[model samples]
Target: MREFLVEITTTVPEGTGQEEVDRRRSAEAARAAELAATGNLARLWRPVGELRSIGVWRATDEEELHEKVLGTLPLRPWMTLTVTPLESHPNDPGRLDASR
Candidate 1:
């Protein structure tokens, strides 16, 4: 599997009801859990004072990452995503730990 760094910014549309927003958020959380269980989502974090999230995700390819993984999110329509493909570094701490 290949890994990607994904930054997601959510913008709820004007005039959207709070109830709808809450429902979508609930669904999004459920979908994220599903993705994590399936190994598509690895780690997730939020920047302080920001409505955006940064996460590490895995997929067979970028296409799968977008279409199958992210596309499945309920809040996708309200989100802007920046995805960066990740490559292994020779001196990465995780790699060093694995090699030990």
Candidate 2:
């Protein structure tokens, strides 16, 4: 598996109902939990003062990351995602700790 950093920005359409937004948000949360249970989702964080999230995710490849994992999001239509593939660094603390 490969790790990726994904930044997601959400934009609700103009005039969309509050109930619909709530429903989608709930569904999105449920989906995120499912992904986490399966180890596809590693970590998530929200940037201060932004309607965006940054997350670490695992997948076989970029295509799978997009199509299979992220594509399953209920709020995908309203989200813009930027994905960055991660490579292990020799001096990464996590790697060093694992080696020990």
Candidate 3:
């Protein structure tokens, strides 16, 4: 599996009903929990000084990550996303080894 670092910044656009925002927030949380449970979402963090969230994810490839994961986020319409694919360093102690 390939790992990716995803950053998401969300804005509740002006004039959007509070009720709708609440609903979406609830849905987003539920979906996140589902993804975490499935191991697709490895870790999530809120960065200091930024109105955004960072998530470490694992997927077969970038296409699957985008189509099956990002595309399904309830906040996608209201979010600005940045995705970076992670390459394990050869000298990293925790690096994945195919022979393992």
Candidate 4:
């Protein structure tokens, strides 16, 4: 299983309230759980920052990962998500070995 990162990037609507934010976040969490059941998601998280990015680390092939993200999330109607392969850094090639 290869690790890929799905980074959600989008603008929050002007005047959006905290309640709405919470609701959407709850929705995302549910969807992430569903993805986990599909053997696609290894882990997921939302960054605490101004950008409000939702990042999911998935263990699967590229196409399966992409399909899972596209099929599972609320990304299409409201947000834009960028998916990238999470590769080991040349200086940190042993990073993944720690998991085994």
Candidates sorted by lDDT, descending order?
Answer: 1, 2, 3, 4
> In order, what lDDT does every prediction score?
0.96, 0.95, 0.91, 0.67
Q: Which of the two, 1 or 3, has more lDDT?
A: 1
- C-alpha RMSD by candidate, in order: 1.9, 1.9, 1.9, 4.4
lDDT of 4 at 42: 69
Clashing pairs in 3: none
User: Candidate 3 regions off by >4 Å?
Assistant: 96-100
Tens-place lDDT digits, model 2, residues 12-91: 99999999999999999999999999999999999999889999999999999999999999999999999999988877
Candidate 4 pairs with clashing backbones: none
What TM-score, over all chains together, does every model reach? 0.94, 0.93, 0.89, 0.56
lDDT per residue (tens digit) for residues 1-100 in model 4? 7777776665667888988877877887788688778766766566766565555566557786656565656544567767788776756855757553
Please identify model 2 stretches exceeding 4 Å from their true place: 96-100
lDDT of 1 by residue, 1-100 (tens): 9999999999999999999999999999999999999999999999999889999999999999999999999999999999999988877878735554
lDDT of 2: 0.95
Name the regions of candidate 1 deviating beyond 4 angstroms. 96-100
